[model samples]
Target: MQAKSRALHEFGATFLGPALHVYAEAIESSGADHLPVCLAREGWCFHRLLKRLQRDHAIDLPRDPVYLRVSRTLLFRAMLGSETITRMALGNDFSGSVLDLMRKRFGLQLHEIFSALPIELLRFNCELPKDKDTVFEWLSPHLKALTTVVSPTRRALTAYLERSGLTDPHVRPLMLDLGYSGTIQKILTHTLKRDTSGLYFIATKPGETAVGDHQALLKGVFHEGVGWRSGCTMLDRSLLFECLLTAPHGQMVDMRQKSNGEFEYFYGREAATQRHFQDLKTVFDGAIDHVIMCRRHGVTYTRGDVQDLYEVFATKPNCIPHDVWHLFNVDDDIAGNGMINPMQMFAI
Candidate 1:
């Protein structure tokens, strides 16, 4: 039945122009409400990961679910209690939009010279903390004002959960992201106070000390393998694909309070950020179109099919047109990360 429906849709696209997008639209919409409210990490890579999760993992998500953009700042601040928030604020030299907001809105610039700044919130709060009392003492005075933003953000998020039906005990929404380690999921679960499950495109298991019980439930689709596996290595070596699958947005830097007593979300932005977003979206759409074209002729995508596709990309990247390649080659964090390089992973 599914195949027949898909065939008809493909037939529509062949003769018709953009009018046939309804079939693609239907495919995109099918399991959106049925599946968990997938919260993808806000980055350029997760878009490809989202495709895999939909096609391979059998998870139905809306076409570019906006709720998935729970940025690192939003998650960390929401999950951290007043104490931890205070500690991090005191222990670090705040910068960027967050710094500006804290200074202008709250008149706060609490810092310590010798103490290590809390560079990564998860690591600082969960893994390392040298002096708790000192952090508390330094930032105690400003805790109330800081929470003005964090608290409202949490309330807004809570409302979002309620609106999305994720808060329902019966619904188990999967958190999707590109993971080196599963810190974001941990903090997200802690913040939501829910037993979350996640699908990471590629990830290593967190150490025993990692936050939240969701770690055990974390599954990787294109995970780092235990031994040398040709398919896995080929997929990993496909740097263009890895770079192509990313969030077009910057990290959510701060939550701002309005005069009317509401909260607004703030994400780190650059002059070229919107342009970068548009380019990545173009690549993502092209990838999905390719998948749709293959399926049009009954060429169903299996796990092996995906592996073959990755190998093709890795070995013969020039197969992609110069225009598309230009879009995929944008300078992004995932490109600089060591994962972009090809590696020999075949076992001798």
Candidate 2:
């Protein structure tokens, strides 16, 4: 096991060396996001992960145009959901770049939405219910109230899905993310009204819910295959999820409808946010270059390779890098509780 572990690490050092170097450079250059350079590093990691999915998993992912279209739409929708919760939680105190972004994105005065909800149910860092039905029950009213805001975005997303071939019968729409119950996937399926599946880099367990004709499915690449697996893999590699899946922008709050009958997204941002995005872009570009080079050289990654590395980490917490310790510590309790265990970072 030790020999194989050493071999895998060496392989990573060699195959992923350039990407790692780029990550290091991005980290050294940025201090915009909380906990040093978290968001920028995440962009680097996400690019590598996406490349792996496209290559090793044979997911039929498209290049820039499709990739950007899907990523931006999905991210905007997901962040809009989060920002709604934040507004409910923070109330008047929620004023900031994030709040402003939500207002602009959704084209709604957040105060009205917050005023309509039972704000007492929300609190700082509060976890939404695990039961999808219950969450829907809670959010349904809010969703209905924001229908005008969300509907146009949903329509835009459906068109985007069609253009990306996800809505086509011959195409299987698969989305990838860091891990856990695929709430994003579920919401997307619900919105797109398509049978969309998610292939998470790492997952806790499986959660399935049927919404109309669409069903949300999730599978983990490394740890859990179908559902949550009770093991050290999820715990030891918890930090890995954090460092890889972050977005550089403030959470998107809503969508504004245009007089032209189209919807435009609103995201929270400031000068610091642009810096974070620029740093993230450097990492992404470097990773893309690394992936292209590897592909040209016939370098292939497999699920087995990922599992081997995960096994070593599962059994040895000390194997995690020292820099990840602070971020790891930030959400140790959440990991212990079996929740998503994501770091607040730029989102909060």
Candidate 3:
């Protein structure tokens, strides 16, 4: 267990090194005027690291990064206010029952969705087609009912954003997140009706396309291209990075404003008491220690270094104990995907 924890910590530091470098470069290129905002809960580490680095004079930023309490589920639900929903908003692919869609996408309970959805649709609560287009076609007829049920949530999200100063007229937010696609950034650009900039650890083809579509300025720190190309092997096991760089909290499921003008947050269930929770925490601590050490010694790591480390862990299953693999789990409750082991997300 000690060896496994140390390996994870070292890997975490190496992973963050290049990401931090790229973030600095992004700040330079995009101008220092934009307010840096880290998207939760993946961006939680980056936000913390940035503040730490700034204190040590390892990196400098015009303003502190804001840790925004938003999620893909909340953003997707907010898009329901629009008359037309894009493929991105609907998700690239979907696989679940209608009930799952209601609960996951709109945060509707069974009782709440039962009253809104037609009887015909309710009967097919087994599973929906995996193809997003097919799912969208099936949902086309009932969008009105779905939107009506979810509109209040959208209003709440808008209010939350406003309360957080994300919608401030004078400030432009540069979103930071560990990335595959820039879905959150794209949605924010649309919702705010303003062009936004995003700095990601990586941006897949869909993300690059969103740059043009939404007029977003997005840069992938490590590899920004279509799929896992020759040099971008890390994208193959991206979920591992997410597992390491998570916040010690449950995912934000819903938010509402009270009559007193205060906001209330609702979170999804989390496995904080899971057996592997302490191990996960230790790995995070290792990463933070690495950052401090690097700053103190003026040491820097290259992207090549990050990739090589990735290869070591990716190729050698023995590097991590067999028991530790199954113990680690990540939640994708936003999509109703449930808990998943990061190692199991890709074939190693």
Candidate 4:
């Protein structure tokens, strides 16, 4: 992440020469609606995390340490949902703000906050090749393929289905399970929680007007796929990225879940109230290294650029499996989360 952030900063500074700084976001919107965890101490660890990533990646960083701290703080403020929540949780009297006017005085780098925590990213392996250009193409070619594909099945269910009792396809328990998974995800995931919706307008940039329409900047990019290519085509996903930038709005959907469960879709958003997809996208483009506590250890997570990274994180980045399962409205909970399916404890 540190290496990637530096390259982007150099590119932006040398080429575009726009501000020589990037306004980054932290735990971006989870593309879809789902209650996100609001951790008060998240920012507290961000600074240290940045250093850890730098050391791990062996990247040369600036001398002034405080900038790193501030950068992470801003990233946390932007991505974690709402500033109001962060303000309230961290305390009513918060400082360390790096907004436009304040930015000149405290120009923080984007790398600081991103490398804060370590999460163990489960090994996706051959299951899904990381392709930023066409995540949708690589993962799910057809939405229905999300269900009909092979899944981790309960051994007994398979044996039972093979027996004569399951002569009728519609009546079969496996069929019912598959049907329930899709039906429930579509219905419940769509219902909105005023707080977690992906597309929203927080506040117009004080004086910084939109480049094109001069409208309140808002939108997100979300993707859902298990493998490299599945239901949606890669071209479609890439086009979606372009669309979000040019078009008025849309949230990036990176939520990845399956009919059964091995992997999952992460439902996420800032802890702040009333933030929009655009804000999330901006913040996401900032960070350096996000920790995965477990698997995928010591491996560099090379995706797209800051913009591309935002798209990946927007839908499904290093997310907790349980979190994703609930967020995207999938029904693979072994403990019977009833939101999608009644507890199948008896069968298990």
Candidates' lDDT values, in order? 0.43, 0.43, 0.67, 0.23
lDDT of 4 by residue, 103-194 (tens): 21112123422232111211121111222123223222322322222122112223322332322323211100001012111111111111
For model 3 the local lDDT of residue 2 reads 68
Tell me the lDDT of model 1 at 169. Answer: 66
lDDT over C-alpha atoms for residue 64 of model 1: 43
What tens-digit string does per-residue lDDT give for candidate 2 at 1-348?
355334433433433434333333332232222111011223335554455545554223333212322332233443344433323222212222323323332334566446544554332222222232433355555654545445556566565445545555644455545555664565556556677665554556554557457776665555564432355554444554453334554334434446785657554332232344544334344445555555456665555564565555445545644322333222111112222322332121
Per-candidate RMSD vs. true structure?
Answer: 10.3, 11.3, 3.6, 25.9
Candidate 4, run of 10 with poorest lDDT: 172-181
Q: Residues 41-92, candidate 1, lDDT per residue (tens digit)?
A: 3333334434554565343454443245565446555533456333443333
Q: Which tens-of-lDDT digit does each residue in 224-310 have in candidate 3?
A: 775865556678776666666666665676677778977787776774324466666555566666767765776777766667767
Off by over 4 Å in 4: 1-45, 53-57, 67-320, 323-348
Q: How accurate is candidate 1 locally (lDDT)?
A: 0.43
Query: How much is the lDDT of residue 246 in candidate 2?
Result: 47
Clashes of each: 8, 10, 0, 52
The candidate 2 region of ten consecutive residues with least summed lDDT is 32-41
Extract clashing residue pairs from model 1.
43-246, 43-247, 44-245, 44-246, 44-247, 45-245, 45-246, 45-247
Identify the candidate with maximal lDDT.
3
Distance (Å) between predicted and true CA of 32, model 2?
41
Ranking by TM-score: 3, 1, 2, 4
